[model samples]
Target: MLYRPNPPISFTGAVLDRADHIRADADKLAELMNWRARLLRLDGLDPVIGDDGALVWGTLADAGEHDELVFLGLDESGRACFAPVSPANKGNPGPANPRLWGAMASLPAGDLATYGGARALVDWHARHRFCARCGYTTKLGKGGWQRKCVNMDCKAEHFPRVDPVTIMSVEWEGNLLLGRQPRFPAKRYSALAGFVEPGESIEEAVAREVHEEAGVRVRDVRYVACQPWPFPSSLMIGCHAYADDPAITIDKTELEDARWFTRDEVVYAMEALKTGAEDGAFIAPPPFAVAHHLLKWWIEQ
Candidate 1:
């Protein structure tokens, strides 16, 4: 079976017999390996490896002997956490040696795609040194999985933060609504998404995002899958919603344009763009993206 990178496996959990013992005492393992340890900076994902060293990819359980490895932090619920490494890390120095700094928002996403978990987590820790409650300095603990507020009275325990977002493909008849953000590369467009607000459920967030971005009410919202969008920590909750209307009233401030396209058009765009399709045509985010996954699910349906 072709490995379908989906669900919990795509972001966390892997099938490995040995790695099940690794998590409880990761600090010891990492510390022991530190001397010969290839210190990897997965921040911003542009990795730089040393001369012909070993690198493990994916979760430790899914890892091979020669693959590069990284350590992501624990989830808020204290379960379901793992790192990511890919075939791309071969012969490349870890992220720290690469000196990558551009748009802050793009770093996490860009790094997760290119680098490993260490880079992304380290970057997250760097930005979250101050406590959200008392604005006091915090210190790393639990193998960098958490930070404790220095203030003894207000010692707030903070874990790596992940914003929950909902991105959906709204279908009406045989057409799907798609949109392009202002910051997206020219002619690039994908599914609509927005952050879940306080006191909101996932379905409500999906409906709200669709209405906010494209001015269309959505119904029959169904959970599809999720992607750990570690661009400084986001969990993208993917869904498929039925569009109640097709006419788009674009919120130009957020989206440059919004429109509906037939499945055939989407297929042609994806295929043509693969072999250098038309310049003015649309391009989807790579298949790894939840947007792409959602789009793929739409097309296949």
Candidate 2:
């Protein structure tokens, strides 16, 4: 079944046709990069929004000879879309600059999704400049969809990778489990989450994270929804589970606090999404996060 939330998750509604087969066709890819092709305008890995709050685009004419162009995909009109690699922003660990977030907030969901994908793709290309296997300089290949080592004897190839993270709500006695990381804004509490480790299933990761972070055993883990979080590329797997014990022994190393919230408190926080309200039991996550939709789905149930 297709997991559809009331409103689609932030970066999952892209309208682009990611033509994967064309990446391997050198002649076809080159043909698509004509004067009609569009280039996404970016500022240090951030989007460059036009006055109308839409993603600003340019033509192939705007590109420099030295630029390394990444094929984003095909637009609705079948015109090719691309983004150039920026040296300064390639390996940047970003939640994005505060000002960029404001500009991004104004973007339409589709544009935001497109930009998120482009940002992640280009970032990966920039950071991975050497062959992991051979430690040789890597050159862009497959229309920037892959990296190939320059060493003749130790030829190697690499592709972009996304880390999987599990974010979940643990319910017990009708209360939802929420926690705050030290980096979160004051009073902000959202679903508990952690990266999925190797040799673990999603269900196991959810249960393990819950017990490790809050000392609460959870079972009956079920997927809720997911969001592509491009803070250097991560897929946030949203889920829900039942907790046998409400008791929380916060792992001070992982969280600043962990607690259960009543249905009334959660409803109050959900309503605050618009006004950016504080002074409640805790600040709820913004709509951009899958946590918000997961919590919203829980409320609907």
Measured by TM-score, the strongest candidate is 2
How close is each model in CA RMSD to the real structure?
8.8, 1.5
How high is the lDDT of residue 282 in model 1?
Answer: 77
When summed lDDT is taken over every stretch of 10 residues in candidate 2, the lowest stretch is 87-96
Off by over 4 Å in 1: 1-38, 42-45, 49-116, 279-281
Off by over 4 Å in 2: 1-3, 275-277
- What is the per-residue lDDT of model 1 for residues 179-206, given as tens digits with 9 covering 90 to 100? 9988776778889999999999999999
Q: Write the per-residue lDDT of candidate 2 for residues 112-175, one digit (tens) a residue.
A: 9999899888888878988999898988899888989999998888998798999998999999
Q: Report the error of model 2 at residue 300, Å.
A: 0.6
- The true-versus-predicted C-alpha distance at residue 183 of model 2, in Å, is 1.3
User: For model 2, what is the alpha-carbon lDDT of residue 279?
Assistant: 62
CA lDDT for candidate 1: 0.63
